[model samples]
Target: MIASSNWKRNFFTIWTGQAFSQFSSSVLQFAIVWYLTDKTGSAMVLSVAMMMGFLPQGILGLFVGVFIDRYSRKRIMMISDSFIAVASFIMVIAGWMGILSTEVILVVLLLRSIGSAFHNPCLQAVTPQIVPSDQLTRCSGYSQAVESVSQILSPAVAAVLYRSWSLSGIVFLDVIGAFIAVFTLGITVIPELHQDENRGKVQVLREAKEGFQILRSNKGMLGLVLIGSLYTLALMPTSALFPLMSMSYFNGTSMNASIVEVVFSVGLLFGSLLLARWGGTKNRVYTIIGSFLLMSFSLFVSGVLPPSGFYVFVICSWLMGVSGPFYWGAYTPLLQSNFEAKYLGRVLSLASSIRLLSGPIGLAASGVLAEKYGVEKWFLIAGGLVLVAAFLCIMISTVRNCDNR
Candidate 1:
């Protein structure tokens, strides 16, 4: 039986806060990416801006998990959200004063990402503390569903608000959303990791090393992280190019790009609901493998199709969306079920960090490649790489047996 009748209450309390946070972030992301694309019309610039946003998360990820494990998860979230809000406030002022430059925008994004570096791992780490073991999958699926809803709304809202609202106006809305997240967080009581007396010295490097050591001991878990990392490397660059693909190749506008984003999120929402209901197959690893393969095929087809295939691209994006929930919902639970609670924050953080770091490498390469060849070709390459990664997971006994672990 589940531990408390109030688990649902607590979970929703935090989830609501997270939902608000994600929605606001998504709105700002669309605003920033579209603004950059509209202003520069250069793939390299987009890639650089994106790299700036994600790089801090990758760099600070190693140490942030240890902080999450040691500190109060609720407090971490509050502080991070506050930090992001403050960054947004600065941007709002800059936008209003007509002093907002590309450099300023990039700096704001970097600050916001550093906050996320701490917030994300803490959020993931606290999940297992609230939900029952068996219900973890359902909760993960529902969480993704909420996130998909946010994504769906963000682009559509941004598309509408883009022409009407000033940059400062949009940023002000984000500030309000952040405060809403903070308020919800304040009301929720999140469980924290307990430190044992006499068992701990204040050694950051040693504790960080211990996080890696936990993964080393669990070969299957380590393999899973590797598989996820490879998958991320393939997917990240392709995604970064989505806006360009719609606008440049398909000769569409911001509204069209937002349409594609909405369709993808709709598909994701449906997929997540399915997971929430079914809780997935008995073998979650197989499900993840299947998800990757499905996404790979869809991406490959997308790239192979011509510019006349904008509709086809939309369909492919939706199919990729369906696969996403199956992959994430199952993957989180697999890790939570397998790893000890004490080490999970570090483990999740390490996995996230490595995956994030790989993205910049792919982005750097894809920026050059996309500028030269085309964005479509990179999609093809990403799909092929993910396909190979799926096969590698199948061949490796440890990763293949991940669900059992």
Candidate 2:
């Protein structure tokens, strides 16, 4: 009971720190994205930068998960946070010296992405150890709510800071946020999963293979992972192109771009709050599928609308935001409940890596597609593909029956 109480306390403590960390990082992200848009005005440059940001998470997550399962999750998070701070500090120095090249920025983004590769899977794996089964969905919702708030604030903050402050100033804030996050982790105690006393020494490669085997043996889970991979592929192009679309298609300024971001985040916050209160349906898979369909429809409608329909695009963006959390809230908790805590780090990490690999692939192509076919048309194509993927999942017996399993 004492351990249980401590777990609750630690959970909140860590969560609060992470919220600050997320906010700062998000601010830096938007500032960089806007800077790229303003400086280059090229879809390809944006895509390449976005790819740099996501590629490490895709490549390193598989190995990072194995480490998470073997070591202390709290330590992993602290180290990852510190790593990010160091990278940010370097970026700040570069910006100060006026030697901040695109290559330097890409390097920092890669380092930050690597830190995330270590941090994220551990964060997800630890939740099951701390929270009760019945409350997992609510916790997921609350987490999304916090992230939404960060998203809501970060863009506006970036917009304001970009007008007056140097890029280094925004990055300095990220360093401070990382310190706070690490400090909070220092104060909190995260429970570790104990290995059986009789068990022999473990092998990471074998265990990783086992992680793959677990998914392969479970057809439903495999199908779900495949669907998630496809979803990531479909969504990346749209997300990476949104800034370009706002500036070029809508004739908007950076402030206007931030406004759209804020609106979508507002919708995210609303949806997260609703899910937190309602806890969603018993069949979370259905909720996931439904979210996909809703988002795809919104994306399609937004893509087809004329540039004069910018207001309508805002509404669709809001719809996309709401559906995103709904999908994640259900999807994450499902994985938590289905997988054992022992293997969760590797299982979840490998799954995350697989899904994330699609990001760079789509992002790389998205630039060319946007350049050739226009950003609006790319959105329509992505939406149509996502819709098809979701429908196929609904029809697949293995995936459809997984919720029952």
Candidate 3:
């Protein structure tokens, strides 16, 4: 365990740096989506772009964990950040040359996703190393709050910058952010795990299989992972189509879309703060279940609203945002608490890969459905599926008994 006094300094030092990178990435992501929405209004195109962003992580994440457990996580994070910076710089060059096609954008997303496959799991694995177990949920809440702050600012900044600046200029911010992340990581002192010399001799596939076995041994955690995958299956499509729902369904402008994004993130910030202070309900599983119900209600109501109900839709969006941190805040800490430190990397990575794989499936179906039946209908479908998933969580004894065990 980390010394009580140094834990905050070590965790926050790296976290504050990550916040800068996240803010820049959020800005760039908004710019890319808006650009795609304006250039090609097709739901299929947007879905494809979103798929490219996560598919690599889904495919590679299963194996990435083996290395995270065996190698220096700090080194992996620094290298990953550097790799993403280079990818963003490539986009900057492409934009400057006026050759920034959708294909080019997808390629950048792929490269960035590959980097994130390593960085994200490494970061999660590092958390328990540096922080006390009892404080994990609070730290997760604080982490979410920092991310929400970036989300809150990024959309409005992207909207204004997108209007005044070129794509290359917007992307350059990511390069700078990555540099800062790498620098802070270089200076921070993260305690190293004791490495087993013989462990590296094991085959990667065998190690991955062991990781799977470790996760499978915990029936409740395994069930929770499945529930999360189902939730992502329902959530991703609606999230992918959010811009179209605002512009196409509601007949709104880019500014209006930004307003929706900003308000939703503001709600996230509020919820994160609440979770940080309260540390959630006694049973974290119940906290997650409540979030699911709240989100289902919001999405369902948003779907039923008239075209002139843009304002109401915005409120629903905020409610959806508010529910987000509760689920993630509870969910992450559950994983951290239940698993041993050595196995956390593989467990988190595998779980993330499973959940992410479901997203492309959802996005694919959503594109066809939204393009044919209209985006508003997807809100209804997604809402219904989430409600079902929540009920499943309630019915499953293993999931209900997870935290208690």
Clash number for model 3? 0
- Model 1 backbone overlap count: 0
lDDT of 3 by residue, 106-199 (tens): 8899999999999998899899888887788889899999999998888779989999998888889888999899998998888887867526
After the best TM-score superposition of candidate 3, give how far the Cα of residue 130 lies from its true spot, in angstroms. Answer: 1.2
Output the TM-score of candidate 3. Answer: 0.93
In model 2, what is the error at residue 281, expressed in angstroms? 0.7
Residue 89 lDDT in model 2?
88
lDDT of each: 0.84, 0.84, 0.89
Better of 2 and 3 by TM-score: 3
Q: For model 1, where is the 10-residue window of minimal lDDT?
A: 193-202
Clashes of each: 0, 0, 0
- Candidate 2 per-residue lDDT, tens place, 1-405, comes to 126657668778989999989999999998998887787788678767877887888888767777787778888889999999998888888977888877788888888998998899889988888887777888899999999999888867888998998889999899999999999989977676777731567676777787778767778777888888888888877876787778888788867676677788899999899888988888788888888998999989978988788888888889989988888898788777778788788888888989998877777678788899888988898898889878977899887777643
- Which window of 10 residues has the lowest lDDT sum in candidate 2? 1-10
58 in model 1: Cα distance from truth in Å? 0.6
What are the TM-scores, per candidate, against the unseen true structure?
A: 0.92, 0.90, 0.93
Q: Which stretches of candidate 3 lie over 4 Å from their true place?
A: 34-45, 93-102
Largest lDDT belongs to which candidate?
3
lDDT of 2 at 186: 92
